[model samples]
Target: MIAPAQGGLRVTAVDSLAAGEGIVPGLPIADARALLPYLAVREADPCADAEALARLAGWCGRYSPLVALDGADGLLLDITGCAHLFGGEDILLADLTRRLTGFGLTLRAALADTPAAAWAWAHAGPGGVLPVGVARQALAPLPVAALRLPDGMAAALGRLGLRRIGDLMDLPRAPLTARFGDAVARRLDLVLGRASEPIAPLHQPAPFRRQLAFAEPIGTRGDIDRALEHLLDGLLVDLDQAGQGLRRCEFSVFTVDGGVQRIGIGTARPSRERRHVLRLFAERLEEIDPGFGIEVMTLEAPVAEILPAQQAALEGGPATGEAELARLVDRLQQRLGRHAVVRLEPVDSHIPERAVTLVPALAPPSHRPWMVEQPRPLRLLPSPELIEVTAMVPDDPPLTFRWRTVLHRVAQTEGPERLSPEWWRDRPGTRLRDYYWVEDLEGRRYWLYREGAYGEPRAPRWYMHGLF
Candidate 1:
């Protein structure tokens, strides 16, 4: 593969055939083409490589919980006690390599006591399992480049005839520190297990996760659903043991082609009900594409909540009220969108328009109650519409009003409720309102409000706020 370099496009990687024909990384494309005119090349995408590496690290979770990205192209797996799961360390290594190789990946791997030692052996020395306490001896013959020194440090050492790691091992600590700072000594210490290097995984491992590996890859929808059910069964058992229920769940399908497909579902409340969760998953099961065939499946609950057991109804029927409502909301959210299912929550405001706000259906119920001291209109306009009014007196309710080009003659009136503007929210000189419940000759009720009091500097303006 070729990529833009300091001068121009250069070979970033090469295939086995290209390497055999004298093509190598870092060589300018011009020189590479001169060596072989018909050479095939593609641009290198660092971003794609990093993403694939992260996915690979996630796939490695089937082996160990602690799997971290070594660099852009390497992965570090701390399989301390997990090696026995696949028989032994040697067997585990073989299995890992075999699976990755089947995915068409070229890999160089080594298992050593320390991360740095393993890195050095994998990149420079022959890849194999290095026994404990053998890193120092095995790495001594490799060149200083294997130490992963800072840029130009290895070249400088080579010019001085200190090309091998054995040379640096015998050098004085003081002189080495003075010449190349502490980087060389630090790397050496790490390889020798003198210093600590902790691996920070690309993604946090889910506490509640279950995996299934099929002996033969399965591609049919029935097989995929069966695997999902089995994984959910195992995961639910874990959640039950912990006295918790999942709030969000993810199902991942690992295809034989090294591609991963994930499907996700969420609950309005924490739940351990298998049938309900299965129903939710059913909504998006068609999204999973079992490319080639799926060899592994994983189910994980990254978000969970404590849910103590509850008593069932005496009649042996499902509990009503909150549980039923929550399930309905969950289904609606899955069918519609997460934001589509919402409830109007009461806001601490006396203004008709500011009395309530839309909130997610899953949101916790507010303790504050809706204002009901006085009757409210059945339907309130988003904004009050202006109207032309003629009243018998300045302080009295309107005798007749023209709204939307239609005149309504008042048959009766009930209120002149005075409401003051909120001092903290309204600006200075803001107007107060006098609201009224008026009935037209046709028996239609209307909520009318006059902004600005009578006889004020600004003349009172009438508005139609709601219908009842």
Candidate 2:
């Protein structure tokens, strides 16, 4: 209760004297009473504490979607892509402080390359962003305790007359690692921004969400339209900075009378243009019915991907515009949702027919864009089936064979192209497969193969797999 009561009420500022002025966190109640006669105390509520912490974490979503609770009293925010909204780094800090104060919170915020450096800054030094790439300079004046060093390591450092981060930074790397072990050196490196540290936010990835609460509910088109632009402006900044564009973006309007009007937009290619994107969504916005007054407008990017640079035209000639394609894909996708539009990328496989597969357009293309030696199939077969043969030659196509229940005579034949299964996967389990290409009496061409054995005494079963 000493800490809890002193939470908003500071030690020097308060006149309400409870006992336990000298008592610390781990001290017993009796010792506390002995130190001071009258201790105004209250029972601790663990449940209430946990609930408050959870609520506070959820509330932090307004400032940054990436927020986590560091300890019982501290919060962690990854403001990497979230700053610049309040103007700049300094202005953001001021705005955050002001907002937290409105929620009756005493906050300490820090910006650094690593979570540890930021942590140290928030607790021990001026709570603000250490200018980019210079966390070490700003962290120098902080006490070694800010490194979160173990008690023994801290004691040893203090004895060596090394009380601050500056002292630790001055020592040779070999000697420090030799005396204090790797943990101390690592913690120091992290706080100094020499080592990388990433903050794990409280919530799972929530793709860019922008929301605005109005002073009063708005039912007019002009008001709704104005609010929509305000939300889009902030979202575009984040996307632009990250070098990403939304494949699917949604705008949701929540009404005071429990009504919701949603509008969505999609793009054929990645984009960052504010006016173009707004224009894309304009169609959906025009369709929104403002049955009741809208109290809030939210813009969210549920699906996003890295937008790469594209070439619009060749050096020699003009290229076609995407205005028509974009409008069509967007309308179909919005009406049917994301799954309606599709794209494909090529994949590598050893099997002649197993070379390519269908995949979503948003997925990153294969790392290797070019594969020259191996010839890829012009078309892929779902699965290869075996073919029966009567040819006397070992590597010759069967003169006559049954395929799809129709026995066709081979007017012209090709050599039996023997393709062995890849043995690297498993030497013991691998079996050799032989493939053959044959042309029938008709103009139709087919790919057929026999598995396991070419021929000894046993007859081979045949299957018609694919067409060319």
> TM-score, each model?
0.75, 0.47
Instruction: Give lDDT tens digits, candidate 2, residues 50-135.
Output: 67776666555545667787866677777666666546767777866775676666567877667888889888988887788777
- Please tell me which predicted candidate would have the highest TM-score against the true structure: 1
Find the candidate with the highest lDDT and give its number.
1
TM-score, cand. 1 = 0.75
Which ten-residue region of model 1 has the weakest summed lDDT? Answer: 309-318
Residue-by-residue lDDT tens digits, candidate 1, 272-391:
888789889999999988878988788899899998866535443666888888988989988898989998999888877888899998688787788776788999989899999999
Error of 2 at 47 (Å): 4.3
Candidate 2 local lDDT, residue 373:
57
Q: Which stretches in model 1 have alpha-carbon errors above 4 Å? A: 34-38, 55-58, 61-67, 170-174, 220-222, 309-317, 349-354, 371-468
